[model samples]
Target chain A: MKAPSLQNTLLVTGLFTASFAQAAELEITVENLTRGIAFTPILIAAHDMESHLFVTGEMASTELQAMAEGGDISGLEMVATSVAADMATNPAGGLLMPAMSTTTMLSTEQMNTQLSLVAMLLPTNDGFVGLDSWTIPETPGTYSVYLNAYDAGTEANDEVRGSGTPGEAGMPVPPPLENVIGMNGTGVAASITNDKVHIHPGNIGDAEIDGGSSDIQNTVHRWLNPVAKVTVVVSE
Target chain B: MTIRLLRMSVATALLIMLAACSDDNDDSVTEVPEEPEMRTFEVSVFNLSANQPLSPIAVIASDGGMLWHTGEAASDGLEALAEGGDNSVLIGADSTLGSTSGDAPLGAGESEMLTLSLEAGSETSISVASMLVNTNDAFSGITGVDLTTWAVGETKTYLPAVYDAGTEENTEMAGTIPGPADGGEGVSEGREALDAVTMHSGVVTADDGLPDSVLDSSHRFANPVMKIIISRVE
Candidate 1:
């Protein structure tokens, strides 16, 4: 677990040069910290600084939109391939239920100094949990980062049940999520205000389990920022 | 960044001087620098729930490991802590350098400080856990936190978020809770629903339209249910 001293390594090489020659193996653990929401297959990718999954204040790419709106990772997987990023897709097999964690080992190749993760938040139209391009520390240590929910800005959050297709109107309630999520929720909103990727304002679900407002449970599905925690142990 | 550079230069000069003083052939006397003491941290948790008191605080000090990570199922020890407000099992099982607990329950707005000391070593992390007594299985605590740069006598304060132990279900029934709010049952062993620790969605009190809930709005809370302060005490 011990790496060469960074002070000595820096003395012998340039900061960027030393980074190019040495890469740390990352042990990543992701936890779903919600009482009710379920996450579709998560996508964890390590890429160079040039690659980005989704950025704020910009329109989501068709690939990003697909994953955010439909819980599909095929489009994002292609994007990861295009950037030559190291990726681990759907490590949990299918949906990651509440209070569940998926532990995975990821080793970054030289030049992949940034990490990005994305997964659709079940019972939502275009909502997803996301971690944007975070700089990987050069120091060998364990780092923890909390992720927040985001709106992909691709579709309206109708809060009802419908198709899982991209650009669809309502939320896609899969089997496990269907039983938990309420049915015939009137709707949350007809459209979105901000048409770019942004922090999700959290679901505004009603207390009624049978039918009132949102299909999602209010006291159950609601969450603050940092809905997920990522613990990365960097090894030499 | 300039001040950091100055500090590094000073350290480098001191290190070079120390290196120069070393003799290749030490026949008489030699001096070896003492390894750094493992950093020790003392964390105190204060329960601030209205009708919901807290179970005994579970204080654990580890290098960088977590007792119960989010999205993970509550271990038996953590489940015991969340369900019954008992820290005996968790504190007993914690493999940290040191673990301690408050003697009695911490009531609403009333605070008590429990001291935990770890020998100074490379392991410079601390974690503290506790449960709200009125709910089904709501608990809260700070997790593997780096206390490396905290100098002796310095103090750090935080308001920790509440977490559902995910052991017992959040039924909020009168006979399910252990706090005075219910004067109800304690730990009943049974895996109800999703058995994993997650962020507590908070109580759906009888005041909030959950007809079955024994808790009222006074029992509800938002993020940061507890104010935690950690001080480095040699």
Candidate 2:
């Protein structure tokens, strides 16, 4: 909401020009804090002050839907490039396992003052952990920020095995994650309550491995807020 | 520049010449000096969950180091404290500079104050942890929180998130929970379900989808389980 004001100042003021001309060097580390949830290929972007990958309470873009549904960042990368964003994509090289961390050194170009990040959560139809347009601190120091899971609100969370393509109905059963996941479930919710992006209500998994409404195990798939922790060390 | 350098040297010389502790073996005790002032801190904690009573809170001040890490396994002291409503082992941890504990367990919506004292000018960090008595191996606390900025009579408050001890599975069984709701066994030897400490996934009571769970909907809880307020009393 406040991005335009920041951009206008950057355009009009000589004072802002001095500070906005130089790029910022950041050592970014993302840690998956969940016990059982695995994060798919991650995307980190440093975009212009007005740009955002996903905004809460707003409709999910087609690019966002693709990533949330299938753990694909190609669409979102196009959006970032269109906005002249500096990005580091999939630094972990693959899906980030639980309680694991990945570090990426990214430099934000001039006027790219805001940093945003997104990564799909495996075994979920459209759930992804996200950080939306956080203003990069100017002072050189180490800072910690926590992230929450957001639902794309485009597809129904069927909680069953199905396709990962956008507009698909069920969750994508990635082969590596299948060992911890259950099988032969019925389904969870057929539709969503809030259509716009919103906080995920977490997974409503059941214990029945052979046949249950949700194929995901309740104790294994569930998570609380601040699902991921990001430590950003700005070295000027 | 010369004057400024001389002034700085004089100040350093005075500071170096000043004796913090006098030698007791000396024949004459030159005006027996009193002990250095102590920094007293009052740590206040309030339980905000639905029905989860907190074990006796452990309020500690340390020079450095962390209370816990996200991916690391819980210490035996932490396991004992999280699984049961016991804080003795954690309070006795070697890293603690000074620590205190509440006399009784703090119930839901209740508040308690714990106090700790340390010699002044000791670079200190604050840490407080307490078990959620209703759950299995779930504890809420803070770690390596910098409270050295507070002056005497100043207080800083914090909201701490709940952490799974990762020492036991959150089965929500009748015979596993230790609170008044179940009055079940507390602190088993080894019932770890996960590798390390992480945020609690919240209680999935019977009312929610887990039909076999002993917990009801009333037993459910969310993050920010405790509000901790720390004050430098002296």
Candidate 3:
């Protein structure tokens, strides 16, 4: 270790109580790293270990179905409030555009030690980006986490123009997606193969423009895992 | 003991120099400029895909520029290289501080090494990119990999994810791909796909689905397409 000089004081002040004693002022940045898929209204919450936005290999809850089917975070917000979770809803204010990024704050309470996030992937059936109950690091400088796309298994991926209502088969087309998404499609998948929530097999788009099996362009709507990148700058 | 002897010699020299300076009142000063050191790195890349022949690797060390960023449109140089497997533009582009390319195209299960040299002082970030010649605009690379803490004799390796340069459509049509598997044209001018670069949704060859595809099951590929091993040799 170096001597406790003026340089040491500056270093100490620069890296304050970043370790986990709880009650941290966290500055979280969410990056929509995908090329063509837009994220509908992201929701980030800091809760105890008991709370989870969505669990893999489990049936989708009615509240989670509503958010994954549509772009509604209201139901999830109410659930977080009931759980006494420190939450930040709709951090991007609206649809987080492809390749864009947004930042939000979560001044976590002592009891809320785990972080979770959820957002819908536009132009898809029941697809969402999820971070399920990741333990908030106590000793933190800057932490980077990559998130993958998941299927809610609540609706079949018809890949056609339909309603945003829960239990719907078609994808909800926001105004921003009206001009972008194609129209008059036959269907991609007839039913959800995996009844339980699982990793998305990704969209299988086609090249036909006027009419095709799927409305999604093969070149545009498809993506790989780890679609979004989340960076958390945790401080005292 | 060495410090004491060195201190006595320096004191005697300083006394003699002070006497000389006082006697002459000289104002002249001499300065010797220091030479800047250069660092060299050897990057060996292995094409790990099924049959996609990788284009000549582009190895660059930069300060802050990104060779290719996800969600952004690929530059003209990147589009040319991704589409045609030609690296002339990316090597001479203004974005790189120092760059080099492999001697030849690396085939499937083949490996090649290229040496790159850069001036010191800047916290250099290494960027490596190569095209999967059989697919339309499919490239694999690492952008802004920090090499600031690297020392001589240290080696680092990475398995990079594949990317779809959203510049050309992945139609698998005839005369679209530039690799020997297709023997089609290269570097055609157009932006037909989504305007943003994204993760490569694996190719749907003819055996899998796409009826008009020039490719077959042998042309299909997945992520972590290339294995890159970088060593600081200097």
DockQ of each: 0.02, 0.03, 0.02
State in Å the error of residue A91, model 3: 1.1
TM-score, prediction 1: 0.49
Report lDDT per candidate: 0.77, 0.81, 0.82
TM-score, structure 3 vs. true? 0.50
Model 2 residue A162 lDDT?
84
Ranking by lDDT: 3, 2, 1
lDDT by residue (tens digit), candidate 3, B1-234 = 222354477579989999988888657886858867888887877675556788999998877678888999998988988999887788787767888988788876556677788877777898999999998889999988887788999988776888999989998888999987688988887896586789998888774478889986446664566778888877
Global CA lDDT of candidate 2, please? 0.81
Chain B vs. true chain B: TM-score per candidate = 0.78, 0.83, 0.83
Model 1 per-residue lDDT tens digits across residues A1-236 = 23568777766678667546356598888899887788999999999888899865457899998898889999999999888898889988899988999989988888788999999998778889988888788778999998878777677666778877887788887888767778777776675644666556556677777777677777787777678998888886
Candidate 3: segments with Cα more than 4 A from true spot: A1-21, B1-208, B211-234
What's the distance in Å from true for residue B37, model 2? 50
Q: What tens digits encode model 3's per-residue C-alpha lDDT throughout A1-236? A: 56668788887766654533468789999999888999999999999888888865557888889889998988999999999999988989999999999999889987889999999998888889989887788876899998878778788777888988997679899999998788888877676545555556577667765577777877898788788999998985
Task: List the candidate 1 regions with Cα displacement exceeding 4 Å.
Answer: A1-16, A19-21, B1-234
Give the Cα error of residue B175 in candidate 1, in Å: 46
